[model samples]
Target chain A: MTYIIKGDGSKEKYDEKKLAKSLKRAGADKHTIEQIKALVRKKIYNGMTTKELFGLAFREFRKLQPIVAPKYDLKGALYRFGRSGFPFEALIERILVFQGFECRRNVTSHGKAVTHEIDVKAKKGSQVLMVECKHKSKEHLTIHIQTPLYVYARFLDVKKEFTKPMLATNTKFSGHSTRYAKSVGLRLLGWSYPKDDSLQSNIEKYKAYPITMLRGITPDLLERCIKKEVLLLSDIHGKSPEQLATLLGIAFQKAKKIAEQCKVCELK
Target chain B: MTYIIKGDGSKEKYDEKKLAKSLKRAGADKHTIEQIKALVRKKIYNGMTTKELFGLAFREFRKLQPIVAPKYDLKGALYRFGRSGFPFEALIERILVFQGFECRRNVTSHGKAVTHEIDVKAKKGSQVLMVECKHKSKEHLTIHIQTPLYVYARFLDVKKEFTKPMLATNTKFSGHSTRYAKSVGLRLLGWSYPKDDSLQSNIEKYKAYPITMLRGITPDLLERCIKKEVLLLSDIHGKSPEQLATLLGIAFQKAKKIAEQCKVCELK
Candidate 1:
């Protein structure tokens, strides 16, 4: 009967299994997962907010395994995107580019009935993609069915120009929306949507962690990095901290800390 | 050169030719048009608002030919629709039903990608129409190109349920929107758009004036009538003033005036 307050001020029964499942999905080893669960159980109290509970778990995971901690909090990093959703769109474009797709962001093209401001357009040899990025900053909200509905509509308008339609998101998709998308051959990539290839898997496979996940940087700094098109950890993989400090106009120590965190996340 | 302040607070040089053309379109006789033109010329002053000029013209038109005056001020009456755009949608549904189409208002149907709340869905034998009502309360705003784009996208989603997509509005369509709609085989219906089959022609041909055009009732009463599904003057064509008063909970004199106005508008 343990109840926890959710981010939206609603109360829900605290479920230990859900936290364990999320930790597992974050690639935490079983031993570390057990230790985190023990710590969370000891700290669990009535009327605690879910944010506090997750923060505790994330801290413990970071302490136990620094390398995998970034991945564990990847969803949180994605949530740091601003309300405009532009940074999320840019991140999707960069991720696609890392995967060998020639990608363009914020592209405008005429559809059959009207012009569309496509978030990301990618092409690889014979494959062309019209990717719509639906970014929600809140954790509980899923990509609804209406998105793919309108997205498919936009694709139908510009199908002559693009070979396929894809919807990318930072969160998961509703069951009905996923089924509808699957039925129409509309590809979906989200936190945990499609079985094998998802937003998480794509980022993990290429180690293209969003710059927001780096330690010792504020949201404002992350925004400037996004504006400078430095979204991925790989974007600063080889650069020295001094170079990053000059590029981002930040303190040398803050840049060094971010650089160190990026190296840790990029570890094999 | 007389400058008239438009509804949007932009100033424009007054054109007598445009006034005459609008009067002619409202079914005014040449002699009456000449008299209204003379009156407008006499009243024209620098820095006069377009609303004031139109009020003078509408008043003169009412005195000369009261029957056609409602049609002349039809655009203004349409602009009285609330920001929610529901009443305008109801008006379009009534107009379609008058034209022998089996019409349904606010119909929800599942498209391939999602469910859409269509403003008006009309059916005639094998011909099915999915109509989107883009009602604008502002007089200066036109139906832009983006509307038909999304409407067509929704149509493509539900094309299995509907034969064609049609965009209807109380205002005019921008030239680019009209051309884009035409090129994509999307039907366009708006004020003075599509020549013979425009919304104005349809209303005049069938005399299906909106209840908002009735002189006696206020906007609150018009909203109440819309809530009671009384959008068209034809809806109250045969009802006596006493019965209308009983149904609408309004004063008998107000109901009588509305009945009298409907009679005048419905005159062949």
Candidate 2:
């Protein structure tokens, strides 16, 4: 057992098996994983932040396979999500699933006055949440405050069993919107709204890393992988190089490269 | 001299020349116009309302031409706007032109955070208005209250020359939306919003009827006409039947029928 400092300054005993599992989930190869495991065992000491540990592993991982370095860079990889034409609703649904909620996507329900096309309807016991995803191509756009009001109106219109309406956007939100959300009791999750519960925070909590965040994966290849329904890093992490090549219709070498780097990419 | 009662119960002497000019504007035939005039003269009385006069003329207009009746039915014809893939912004611009406002269409402007695509910008001296048209296919959809808020945010982002923003929609707006619009000072012109200043009122006030509202025109034919930029009812009102047939590449009878009907359809 190794004591490692976390981002929040809390220290926890790190298990090698957990590290290896996450690395495998990240798509690291057997040889790379063994190398990273040996390195972690040798260098890891008390008071070393997980950030430092991640940097150490990332450096070694990059040296072994530079093509997959970005796949391991969580924050940078999340930003790269803006470039892909992936289904955002699926990402949100997966996060809801990770949160132990049942989700029905693209539901059409009749309102009192007008029918609504809900993007996702999540349910658990008597509590229900309707989530709206506003995906924009550009990073500069922000969700205005009225979105909460608009979303809330729709929620009231068709509140059959839902507890409340929550809006999720890939971009940030305005100050007005955050205040409006609080006032109207509309749950909002954006790039940066409701600082405690944002889209970024949800992704972090769920660990739903986008496959496009990987360095070796070009948008064209990512699109092909998405076509094959391999949307996230974990979706393709467990697959063998040969299987990946066959499924993604790429070369064995490229697939192996992707698979190997992804497996040991996580230092923690 | 025959006196006619008006909508407000005021009396005015009916002028035959004024009647003939309005008939021509409504796309009526000369023979039909003459017949209607004769009927109006035969039926005129001091207590006869202008509504009664209009009804008498409409009955005669319908008898002379059944196909063109809907085109003259302003409200019903406006509803037909949903059928054709007509460029609505252009129609709105034409209305603005009649309102004596100079316009520029689809102008792009850079804001502090992001660039915005302005739909239509109308300018008159020191006063300028940025207009956004929200065209929906379904009649049931209402512009939510947040739209005013959303639009106002965009307006604030890029307020180059336009001092005010106006949102126009083909459908109705939510009660909350109307209240919000009033609160925020965002001018809204929907099917029945800003009751004194609505899209319906604008259409009536400007006499800017869409070319697609013509009865002799099919959606396919209207598409072709729109492609040729013949968007308003008055665009081809001056063209001869043969010229219209030649220009539109349709049969002589069809063009003649359209030309004949459009000439007097404006007799209000």
Candidate 3:
């Protein structure tokens, strides 16, 4: 899983639960998430890289974000990455997907007269984490003030079932900004570079959060475990010649030979 | 300006003129180049970065390439950089604009059945240059084979006024492919890393070639020159008053006073 520090110097895993929560928080409806999922699944192919998936999700989300914005100006702002912000969104999404979460990029909420879009949405089990990712230089940390405003817009669109709002940024938050988030009951997931010990702890803490908050088995974790198993099995299959390996620590060829004999006996 | 080495292990400058020639050779119509120049000029704003302008022109040219392809695709191929072969037709236009060339990124012909577009048209003295650009990886070179084919299709559309063909790649070309291009008389511009001095010389040799048969410009010189200028200006702008005084061989107070004067005079 890709890991990043949250705005409050906490390490957070970019997982499916986090993505779902983020989407819900960003005001995406269940229908929208399902639509996005369908689009991503259809586009997916074998040996697909994480970056490719993120890009696909991003393009899909971009189409949706405009539909949710309140005004054309707001829609423009969401689409505008101002250079550096462009690649950062994809990187964040990739991290989340790697950590075992299902994520969609550029989610938009369509309303009667107004629309809103979130950068990413991650869902795992019942916990739906909404993330607002910012990639500003350290000197521009003061820009954190705008983060909540964007998050609040998303918060209004989230379904009632999800818990907790989180903001993620590559830049550290100012003390004043942290205090404001705390007062407002918003979770700040911040990370400091050069080996941030605090971030590591936050990941561990969040991992233990009650699973009931998540819908079911975290899709992100399940995917990761499955991928790992597939990789291990493929490695074994490469070395072993037998269809069935022996229970004992025998050579793969011997196991395959035994399996073939067993198959012959069964055939007879 | 981005510089790159050619396939023959030579360094080359990404000259706007060379790009223009490639576009002309690709069979782009004069009207297309004119339209592109106007568009770029109209959309340009103060403090616009080179990369931003390139993207703007690329988008514009993407809208026009299909229209002029009947006569221009062969020469236009040299401007593409990436795998998608989406026309970066505005690259030369942007380069020229950066160098004070009066070029525009405008639309020429619109596709009725296809949504694809072309970028811009360029004029140097009496000559008009039509271009498209591709930004691609070396591993994905095959992705661009269809580009020439598309240009060929466009050639058929316009009644064959444009006759030049050009192909540019940031990655190295395969020997078999190079031989194929040579056999067919297609101009292939392959670019690689620019740090090598020998490669740079080869690029220079290609640069000296007439636009009629030239493939593409080297990305190394263009990128280096732009980088040097940007870096120098950034450093100069970041200096403290005291530092400026030392550099100018003047007293700190006097230097501050002069700096203020220079700022007022727009001389800094």
Least accurate 10 contiguous residues by lDDT in model 3 chain A: A207-216
lDDT of 2 at B230: 80
What order do you get sorting by TM-score, best first? 1, 2, 3
Q: Write the per-residue lDDT of candidate 2 for residues A132-246, one digit (tens) a residue.
A: 8877765456786557656776676677757888988777887767765665567887764567776666665665767766664577886787688776777887789999899
Docking class of 2: incorrect
In candidate 2, what are the lDDT values of residues B232-260, reduced to their tens digit? 76788879999998888889988887887
Who wins the TM-score comparison? 1
- Model 3 stretches astray by more than 4 angstroms: A1-83, A98-100, A111-113, A138-140, A159-163, A193-268, B1-268
Q: Per-residue lDDT tens digits of candidate 1, residues B6-121?
A: 88888999999999999987878898899999998998999899899989998999888876778788887788864567888877877788788999888999876567788899
What interface root-mean-square deviation (Å) does model 1 yield?
3.7
lDDT of 1 at A266: 51
- State candidate 2's DockQ: 0.06
Q: Candidate 2: lDDT over CA atoms?
A: 0.72
Error of 3 at B177 (Å): 54
Best first by lDDT, ranked: 1, 2, 3
Model 1 residue A256 CA deviation in Å: 4.5
* Model 1: lDDT to the true structure: 0.83
Each candidate's lDDT (Cα)? 0.83, 0.72, 0.41
What is the docking quality class of candidate 3?
Answer: incorrect
Per-model DockQ: 0.27, 0.06, 0.01
